[model samples]
Target: MGRTASVLLRVLGMLWTAPNTGLGLIAGSVGLPFGARVHFDPHTVALVFHRWPWGPGGAMTLGNTILHTGETLDAPCLTYAHRAGHCEEPPVRIGDHERAHVYQYMALGPLFLPLYLVCGGISVRNRFERAADRYAQTGRGWWPW
Candidate 1:
């Protein structure tokens, strides 16, 4: 895909996930300021630093933190601290996966949430999650699933 289209998808992702994005921004500004450093990539998605020690601990939480609302948050931003004493994978790989989720947001818009819930299962069975995994492995500029 062209850069313009990629950017447009990201913008649409932001708008589609606005409610969660707003909560993430608010959380970052309020409680997360000292807890984590926020990083916004060229894709315009926000990544928050979340040390595993301070909050909940899990491998799933290591990348895009899935909230109670069932939203896998990669848009807007949230800190993702590596587990203490464990070396997480390089940011490039993680970013690729997360970026794919951002694209999913763009494609599904408001429908993403409910659909994600209905399709809830292991990543392998979930079409959205599978597409994201594919994107991470393949790189950018492909059609959104």
Candidate 2:
């Protein structure tokens, strides 16, 4: 794709996912008073909130916002990074997995959460989550479908 087309697609994806992103932003806002730090990542075109102080003690991706209780992973993707907890295979980098969710959210838009629940929410059986893991491991296949 040409640069213009790529840019346009990115913009379109952002627009399509705006509603969920807004919700994510609202959720992230609650973390601000608790010392959550926020930063804009131009590479992924998303907002990341680290040290969010909530959730199941890990990272969560909602649209373009990612909330995490731990620090961002910068080292090589580790064997224990996958959320499914199956260590026989390689692990999925949390950053990559969450970023893949952002991409998935762009494609699914408001349908993301509904479909995610239908796919078993956050379990290993959830196709959305499995796809995110696939994306993290291979750099592709973020789409649940």
Q: Give the TM-score of candidate 1.
A: 0.57
Candidate 2's TM-score: 0.89
Worst 10 residues of 1 by lDDT: 61-70
Q: Which pairs clash in model 1?
A: 1-141, 48-78, 48-79, 48-80, 49-79, 49-80, 50-79, 50-80, 50-81
Give per-residue CA lDDT, model 2, range 42-65, as digits (tens). 756689888898877767778888
Write candidate 1's Cα lDDT for 1-145 as tens digits.
9999977866776677776555455554453445444544454255544432233432121112222211223322221222222334333354455666655655565666677768864334566655654565567542434
Q: Rate the local accuracy (lDDT) of all candidates.
A: 0.47, 0.80
lDDT for position 99 in model 1:
63
Name the top TM-score candidate: 2
TM-scores, one per candidate: 0.57, 0.89
